[model samples]
Target chain A: MKSDIILAGVGGQGILSIATALGEAALADNLLIKQAETHGMSQRGGAVYSHMRISDRPISSDLIPGGAADLILSVEPMESLRYLPYLSETGYLVTNITPFVNIPNYPDIEKVMEEIRKLPRFIAIDADAIAKEVGSSRASNMVMLGAASPFIDIEFSKIEAGIRTIFGRKGEEVVNLNLEALRRGRQFAEENR
Target chain B: MQKHLFLGVEAIGQGAIDGGMSGVYSYPGTPSTEITEFIQENPLAEERNIHRTWTANEKTALETALGMSYAGKRAMSCMKHVGLNVAADVFVNAAMTGVNGGLIVTVADDPSMHSSQNEQDSRFYGKFAMVPVLEPSSQQEAYDMARDGFALSEQTKVPVMLRITTRLAHSRAGVARKEVLPENQLSLPADPRQFILLPAIARRKYKGLLESQNLFLKLSEESIYNRYEEGAEKSLGIIACGIAYNYLMEHYPNGTCPYPVVKISQYPLPENYINRLDQECDEILVLEEGAPMVEEMLKGFFAKGTPIKGRLDGTLPRDGELNPDLIAKALGKQMFSGYAIPEVVANRPPALCMGCGHQDAYVAMNEVLADYSKGRVFSDIGCYTLGALPPYETIFSCVDMGASITMAKGAADAGLIPAVAMIGDSTFAHSGITGLLDAVNEKSSITVVISDNESISMTGGQDSSAFGKIESICIGLGVDPAHIHTIVPLKKNHEEMVRLFREEFAYNGVSVIIPRRECIQRASSRKRNKK
Candidate 1:
């Protein structure tokens, strides 16, 4: 009945889409949700994060305190490790293996993956490849969200419905493609975990 | 009633609309831009034809809102914390002028400087102006306070400030709507010379403002936003202000703090509740978002009161924001922390977009400036400020809005010949004009680079007031027309841009080189909108 998630990625990487989908699903279930987002200057391709908390009871803080996050769901591999301090000891870290190499001094991809592999419970997914397999590479964020879905408290069907509601305006083809991307990602996580 | 999910800014917008706001004025800044944007896009606001448009700057925005209030229509003006500094003259005087109709001044403060230069608290401004300030602890309260803030303003015949920090402003939560109230009919102030600040009349108005302190305090004491709750423990009394209350409650998830708590969202310190807490507890802890205003006041100049502790006393860090862990640590509660970040994780600072016009402009400027000694370029607030960072590093200063031109002028006056001022089009419109006029009159030896991206480009591409009129404005301000050159900022035009920059930098008198291009982000979004 409670979930504290950290959505992390480089700005413009579409992590907010995952937040929107989760927020819609949480609200549909009549759960109290608080999501704190990064806006303004940081949106210009900087490290960005959104702290999302959903509970059956009234939520107190917009922020998920350090080490209280149930899941660190990141769309980028290196960006996932950036929020390790917020992840609970037994929490899940579901992150995309693709690196967003905007900075000149980005660490080696293998080193970043090594850090992620050190986590007690984590799913290192090739979300981009999965989304491409489902039809659109742009749906990578959806894939990452799906990979994290197993750890979230919400039901899978509700998440699908949430996606339908959010992407309803974008037409059925786009919605169905994203759903497939989500399903493929979930399948990968289920098999890998 | 079904709850509508809303960001804190959106809640305020909806609240203002439902509370029958006739007009909403603002200049875009982070954490505060969405309030006006929400009103701009709302169906009801459109149907009612309420005033919602970007102003040139915060000062003009507040003044326009004040004009609407002068006509007895509920009005709101919103801005980020620094914007208040630009509008402070009118803000303070408005307290003296009072209001004919309800006026709410909503200010969003960025505590961690997420998108700001400083973290100065706006509560001090409210206290200085001696007006009521409502700092909501939640999105629900954000809605309710903005809805009822106008009433508070009207009751006291002064402006009410609805203040929020960046966290509350950007955070999303469910907010239920209230029944929509009708906008007030237009009417004039009862006193004919009320707004006229001619010394004799101003003195009397100032006296009335001073006398209203008691009424303001009484209202604060009676405010629904300010409350005192009894607890089992009295060893330490805690005063949680605004969003800090939420962080405090986060520690006690069951909603029970052992210490007696005074939750303050309404201003003037809510003295009565504090006095009660002071009498009962051995020591007091003050929790606030920004500056330790309450803590300092309680401790006083002599620092001999109730063993008060906060930022000043190091119960909390002196700078940055207050998070739940910080609060828990202060309370001596068990803390939770996970693994440290790997050493290989490098910093990824915000950068100009890959195909951004500012990038091309900076490339040209940096190439031209390579010949000259470093530390000559003065920049203003905008996305171009990122030029101060790696890859380009063309700009030397990223001071306040429009400080580029004036600072360049000062440096030139101090004999740093050919001083360069790099400013954005929107910022040039904001406050650069006055400084440009001064430079023109003095014929200062400075090269002004008006990087015209044709939008604010920062704070998410709000329309720039100088969109198509930059050249005309510069010319009208008495800059020599021939010396003002325009070049398209693109890969193809790099040589021309470099030539223009070199030409202007060598000019003995004031010269302006405009690198014109639409922000790629704005251009793409426009394309999407068209599609």
Candidate 2:
């Protein structure tokens, strides 16, 4: 009845879009949802996060308490590790393997992957490569959502519908590319599992 | 019956619309920016011909809303906590003048200094002005408070302060909308001189304001927003205000807290509920988003009454925002198994965009300023503030909106030759022009770089009030035309920009440099929209 998710990534990386897709999916299921997003200065290519709490009952807090998040779905690998404290012991973490190398001192990629791999319940995928293969590089976030989709409580079909609903304005071609990206990501997660 | 998923800011806009607001005025600032943006974008608002426009500054926005209210139309003015300081003169005086139509002055406070200069609470402002402050716990309450805030304003004939912090303002939830109320018809105040606070008349009005406190308190006690809920335990009474109530409620998911609780949204501090909680409980913890206003008041100078716990007593953090984890810690609940953050993650402080004009301008300034002492460059708010970080840490101080120009003037007067101030176009329009005038009059040896991005790029590209008028405004303010130089911030123009900077730095009197370029984000978005 309740799913507390932490969406993490660098700003302008479509993390909010992922939150919105999941939120719309939750709404489609008649679930109450509260998504607390970072706005203002943080949006200018800074490390950002959004706390999403969905429930059958009225959600009390906009934030997910530390160590209570059921899922930490991130679009960037380093950003994923940034919120490890919020992840429940039994929670799942699905993060894109690619590093958003904005900072001069970004950690070694292998080390970042090593830290993520240490977690029991985690899936690290090359979302960027998969998204490019799916015919749109911008759908990397969709690939991330697809990878996190199974761990999330919402139905895959519902999430797909949510994507279509969100991307419908951009034209059918864009929608299809994102759909393909999502399916590939879901397939990768399923195969690995 | 209609429910729409809305951010807390959007909910306020929706509530204002449903509450029959005729005008919504504001100057764009973080957290508070989206409220006016939402109203401007609403189709219903357009149909109603609502007066929704970005003002020159928060003061103008407040005054414009007051003017609309004077015409007997419900009006709302919104701004961030700092913006309230800009509009404080009008806000304090408006309390004395009272209202003809309803007026709601909504302010969004950013705790933890997120996108703000300071985290000063606006509840203090409401308390100082002796006006009722309404803080909503949820998006629903945010909607309801904004909808009903008008009636509260009209009934009391005083502007209501609908105060919300950044979390509530930016947080998203489903808001169930109410039936639309009709806007008030145009009518004047009963007394012609009601707004005129002449010395003799001001004393009478001040007395009326002071006397109105009892009525405000009575209303607060009677308000549904302020509730005293009985519970089985008396070990620890909880006093949660606004969004803090939501954090408290998170602990007791079944809609019940074990301790006696006072959920405060409407303030004058419903004394009846406080008295009951004081009598019933052993210890009381006050959980408010901002300052420990109520906690301090209850635990006075003598430190009398129940052991009050909150920010002051290390029960919660004295600074920054309140979170569920902090709330749980206060309640002696289970703690999170704190995972050590990897040292690998470098701090990703916000920076100028890759193609941002500010980047090029900063690059040029840094190169030019190498000949001079560092820390002489003063900056103001906007995306340009990012220049304080990496590659080009050129700016020394960014105190407030207009402090840069004036501070540069002061430093120049103190013999910091060729003192420089870097401000954005919107910020220049906000408060920099006056300082520029003062520099002109004093003939201060300062170089003012008005980085014209042609938009208020910091708060998500709201229309810049100084869009195309920065040059004219500078000239009109008495700066010599020849001294006002313009340059495009680009790689090819880097040499020219540096040359201009060097020339201005050597100028004896006031010299204005405008680095002109549309914000890349705005430019791209505008292009996409056109396509």
| TM-score, one value per model | 0.99, 0.99
**Top-DockQ candidate index:** 1
* Per-residue lDDT value at B317 in model 2: 93
Q: Chain A TM-score for each candidate, in the given order?
A: 0.98, 0.97
Off by over 4 Å in 2: none
Q: How far off is model 1, as Cα RMSD? A: 0.8
Pairs that collide in candidate 2 are: none
Give the least accurate 10-residue stretch of model 2 chain B, judged by summed lDDT: B336-345
Q: Compared with the true structure, what per-residue lDDT tens digits does model 1 show for residues A1-193?
A: 9999999999999789999999999988889899999999889999999999999998999998999999999998899999999999889999999999998899989999888898889999999888888889999989888888999999999999999999999999999999998888898899988
Worst 10 residues of 1 chain A by lDDT: A127-136
